[model samples]
Structure formats: structure tokens, C-alpha cells
Target: MIRFQLEESDREVGRFWIGFLHAFRTIFPGFGQRFLAGIVDHHQQPAPTTIAQLTNELEQKNWELILENSSLISSENWWSGFVEWLQPFKEKHSIVFLEDSGKMMRKAGEELIHGISPKLRIALTASEIWWPRWFSEEFPGENCTELWHKLRVANNIKDFSSEIILPKRNLLTSLQNQLRREDQELLIQQIRSMINWLQDQGEWLEAVRLMQNNKDFEQAGEILQDKVEDWSSSGADPLEVLFWLKELPGVLLTSKPVLCLSAAQAANKLGFNFQVSYFISAAENNLYALQHFSRNDKLWREMVLDESGTTVQGILAQITQIRIGENHETEF
Candidate 1:
């Protein structure tokens, strides 16, 4: 089969011609070759036989069939047939019919929204109606644009804060109430999947923020703990990690000595001497509490005490020496 090996600029035109030719063929079978022959110089080769051949010749020759045959291409019968052919083959061909016929797509989406139940409409519009690239420029309505902006801001850390977070949180809660029971469950599953994907991509802050937004505090804490462990083991940058640890709920932060030690190590790396002392003190206190109250908890002991049996006090001494400008390396 003939192919165009289309460039980025040519892809939309290519899809349009391919779709148009298929529509033309459906309307006038056995005449495609003759049409192709008439459109270009055919002295050396016989008229192209297949739709692919016709599309390739037209594109290679730089013939603008879409504009040349605009009337025929846009005629009601032809356009309908083109859409019908496009719907099934678009995915296979990597065709987004919307790029060429966005007005029609928008109209159809609006009509679909009108016909669906409110719950389904919200779910469908949020999940599918707005194309990713066109969200800011071509989004259909003001409300949609605002909602999309809020969603975007919610994911971003720089834009996230207590005052800004509350509005987005309330907006999300409002939208959640409009979704059906099953759709609500599906939305949660999708958010969870997105969180897992973010974590896999090493976007721990973004993942934790999403969990916190959804009120999954326990899961968020678990992710924070995992992030600390990852940094401790892999020697990753700890500045941002320490900041997040400082923001954790007081009760949660104080309950885990390993977390405090991780924060202390992070503070030490960033040259925050006061923070280093504070975190080390907190870790010492939490270690004592764990030893007295939960002696059976070997996991905390294993994490807090190094394999060399270095205690919290030893780690503190090492941090003190480093803070005093002593050229000594410290490990947590």
C-alpha cells in the first residue's frame, strides 16, 4: 500500500484526505482511479487503484484536494459518510477528527451532554469532553475553563497552599456529589491509579498532595514514610523532603523516630543547623517513647539503629561535629 510518511505538519491534512477519499469512494465506487488520474500527471504510471494510493499521490504531489474539493468534502452526505468511516478507523490511523472538525465535535459533545443525566454528564465532560491540549484555548464554556484551571492548580505544588487549597477542595467535593455512586467509585480508582503512577515516576510530593486532597491521610502518611526511606537508602536530595516532613501533622511526625531521623539527616545536608538540632532532639525523644511503650516493635529499632549499632545519641554527636565545621562524614 502507498504511504505518505507524513511529517507533523502533514498529518492532519493526510488524515483529512484519507478520510475524504474513503467517503468519496463510498459514494462513487469504481471511479476513484479515474478521479486520481484526473487530479495529477499520469504519463508514467496508470491511475492509482486504492484509496491509500490516491491519498499518497495527492499528498506527494502537494495537491490540496481538501481545499480544491471543499464543496464536495463538506457536503452533508459526504461529511456524514466521512465521520462514519473516521469513527472506527481513527484510533488505528492515529487520527483525531477533532483537529480538522473541532466545531462539529464541540457541537456533538454539547448535544451529548444535554442528553445524558446530570451525574453522567459531569463524569463524561470531566473525563472526555476537554482534549488535553485544547483545554485552555478551545474549552467550550466558562465553567469548564474555570474547573479545568482549578484542577491544574490543585496538582501543582507552587500554587498549593491552605487558602488556595480550600476552594479547590470544595469544588472537588461539589463535583463528587454530582457523580453517581458507581462513577464516584470509578473516580476514586482513577485518582488512586494516577497517584500510583506519580509515585512510580518519583513524584512523591504530587502523589501525596493528591491523597491529601482526597482525604486519604493514612495513605498520604504511608507515602511520606516511603519517601523518607527512599531518600535515606538512595541518598537523594532531602531539602524538599524535609520541608514536607515539617508540614506533616504533629502527632504523625512525632510517632515515627525514623522519619524524624530522616528529617534530621536532610536538615544536616542542607546546612540548616538549628533544624538539624531540633529534628535530632525530636528523634531522640520519639526513640525513647518507642522503646518504653512498644518494645516489641523491632521495625522501628531496625530503622533507627544502624547495622553498626549506632544509637540516636551517636548520630546526634556526629551531626554536632558536622555543625561545628568538623570535616567528618555522617550517615543515618
Candidate 2:
């Protein structure tokens, strides 16, 4: 059995455990704690040395993970996985790692967006899509490079911002202070509009859809702040952005980072910021709910495989195998 770790660099919080094995792929090559075998799962009370044990542990940890996620997950829930209610498992395996990775990644993405802006980070994600590293090899390309410049700008902004977060206190202070009154005001407008747009989960979904189109993201975000200020009056929410520095309630709440703040710190090193962070944050924060769409994402893999004109087995092999040259991918 091969012990594969999510090499530290490849683990982006927003993209992390969010969606592991797709629903359609759930049973393949085996799942649950089965990734860890005998040494971890042999006993009546097996230790988590293998995937089966890992699954059992994941189940126990899922609840706790959700509890931890309560910060974003919140204490209340209108609906839980209805399937779990109908039939419970003999051993516990959780969707929590996916949740943790999802939430954490969202947070990371949002934080990155604050500086990098989620738009740019996303471009980078797209640019790297077919790269041997992350893509499962079979994945087709969307060729969204037209917005490459826009995305690159956002990533550059984030890179510069990360530099602001250096060990030197003076640099942080200078950057913090230099983020002038005008910039702060612009931030307020951005947050307000985003919060307004993100009112419900559906609108949020549409926005996310828009993000997938490189043209949409670069245009929407690149011009967003500046455009809003172009029309707004002076003195709307003077203290809004400053409020976020301290993680203030309500005011900063709307100021969601394009990438998630939770996972932001981790991605600070990604040479490029992918903008999927904000949406990631929304799901993790539970500020947005996951609505069931008419089309099941489970079928996404099938559609992808169909495009590749290969059996699922072939596609599976394509996705699981790492691509070369793409950073973070373990070359075989």
C-alpha cells in the first residue's frame, strides 16, 4: 500500500478536502478508512494505520470537526444529510475532512483575495489546470487565458500584500497605515456590494458560476471596486475596512475575503493566488447553504469522462496520476 500525503504545498485550504473523491467515484479503488489497511484496521478496536481505520477515525472526528467548524458551521442546522438519518453506517467515516479542507481552503482563499483578489488566484488555477501537477491528466482545458492579465494583476497584488505581512513589524505597520482613506472607502463599497450580491445561496451560486468563466471574473472583480467608487458618493462607511482588521462583527462580516481567511495563511506561499477562496469561505462559514441543484455534480465526472471518450476507469487513472511540471504534484 502506498502512503500518499497531500504534500504541504499542494494543500490549498479552499481546495483541500472540500470535494475529495466525487460522489460518483465514491466506491472506486475503495474509500473510507480503507486507505489505511491492516495495521490500522485489524483489531476489534483497530488503530488508524490504514484507510479503513482512517475512515472510522474520520467518522469520529467528523462530528468534532463540524463542531470546530461551528465557528463558521454555526450551532444551528435546518437540515443534515438526510441519507445518514435513513441509514447509519456500522463504522463512522465522515465527510468532515472534506469539510475541514473545504472550510480551511475557503478561508485561505478569502484571505488571499484580500490582497491577491480571488479573481487572479482563480486565473492561476485555470492556467495550471492542465499542468501535469494537479490535473488528473484526462481533464480538458478551458483556455481562459484572455483574462490572464487581469488574474495576474490580482495575484501580483496579493504577492505584494504577503510581503507586507513580513517578520518586520515596521513593514506591516507601514502597509497598514498606508492603506489610505481612499483605499479603505473603496474597500467598504466592495464589501457592501458583495454582501448585497451574496444575499442568498442561489445568487452566490450564480456568482460562483460567473467566476468559472475567466472573462467574467477578471472583468467583474478587476473593475468592481473602481467601478463602484466611480458612482458612489463620498463618505459611505469610513470605518468599515478598519473594522475588519480587528475582525469586528457585522461590518467586517460582509467584507468577506475573496479567498477564505481561515485557509488564507496557508496559501500565502502559492506563488499565485487562486480566487476560489471567497466562495470557499461562504460555504465554510455556512453563511451560504449548499442547495441541491437539478443537475447532480456527481455526474460531473461522468460528463468529463464522456468528453474524453474513455471508460470511467481510464479517466480515473488520468485524474489520480499526477501531471509533470505543475508545482506541488508528486512526480512518479
Top model number, lDDT: 1
Residues 1-332 of candidate 1: C-alpha lDDT, one tens digit per residue: 22222112112232344334545455445434433322211111223354455545444332211222233234434346545644544433444322232234333334333443453344332321123322222324435444435445444112334222222222322344457666766566556655675576576777776675565766776667755666566866565566456445546665665566677677667666556666667767866665664446454444445333545555555556645652344433
> Per-residue lDDT tens digits of candidate 2, residues 222-290?
223222232223432312211111121222322433212322222222211331233234323432222
The worst-scoring run of ten residues by lDDT in candidate 1 lies at 37-46
Q: How does model 1 fare in lDDT?
A: 0.47
Clashes of each: 0, 42
| Candidate 2 residue spans exceeding 4 A from truth | 1-30, 33-52, 55-185, 198-202, 206-332
Output the worst ten-in-a-row residue range by lDDT, candidate 2. 36-45
lDDT of candidates 1 onward, in order? 0.47, 0.28
